[model samples]
Target: MFALISLSDLENDFINPYDLTQRLNRFVALEYATQVVLVAVLLLGGKWFLAGLQAAMLVYLLHSWHVKQHTVDATDVFRQLPVQKKRRLIMFGSFLLFFVIITYRFIESIIHGLLTEEGRAHAKKLFQDAAASVHGY
Candidate 1:
């Protein structure tokens, strides 16, 4: 959520809403809002603890992006290129592929590292402490 908010703010004047990053951000936000609404309505609707936060988020998402009209251009020139030309977009600097793959591998390694036995034990201990604090233990 911070990432979405930050990118949207940073790219406030982004020329194309149809841009892949923007589209992905929107899709991710939509999925999140959907999950929040579903969880709030189905699970926490009657709870007094966190229901208000959940409901407020639903209201916020609905009031903000839902009511706004964000249109993607159907006649975008970028979309009119031949399939082969489109495939060669980053070919001028083949390093782009290497960068993407390396970045993906680095992130994957970090994710895997966080799931290692020691990492999981530490995370579980932290979560248990959080739960205890929340419950006033």
Candidate 2:
């Protein structure tokens, strides 16, 4: 999602209010769905550290979104900000911490995958295929 936003930013596609709002809404929905799945998995796995991290992330997301929504509803302070800037502010403010946990989980999964024999075989096959393609094989 951050990558999507970054690409959109690069393309300067959030200039339109409707597009920005739509993207933000989609982001919000994705965030909620992701958190729900993470929380459920953590609960089922009984991993203390990850469960705690997910809990903290969920709380932060809820609180930040709530506050931002209220702030936007209550005042004109953000009126001068561009739609893209506002989107960035809301997104980063809400999910930056969550991203840290996400990165940690991603790295952990990659390491775990590399540790398995099947995973190593799959990776080797992928690299071999890439090499074959590069060599026009």
List per-prediction Cα lDDT, in the order shown: 0.49, 0.63
Candidate 1 lDDT over residue span 38-132, tens digit each = 54664544644345544554554455446441222324423433321322242223335445755886799878977899988887898999999
Clashes of each: 0, 0
Task: Indicate which candidate wins on TM-score.
Answer: 2
Q: Per-residue lDDT of 38-57 in model 2, one digit per residue for the tens?
A: 88897898867777867776
Query: Cα deviation in Å at residue 17, candidate 1?
Result: 5.5
Off by over 4 Å in 2: 1-14, 68-137
* TM-score, structure 2 vs. true: 0.47
Clashing pairs in 2: none
Cand. 1 TM to true fold: 0.31
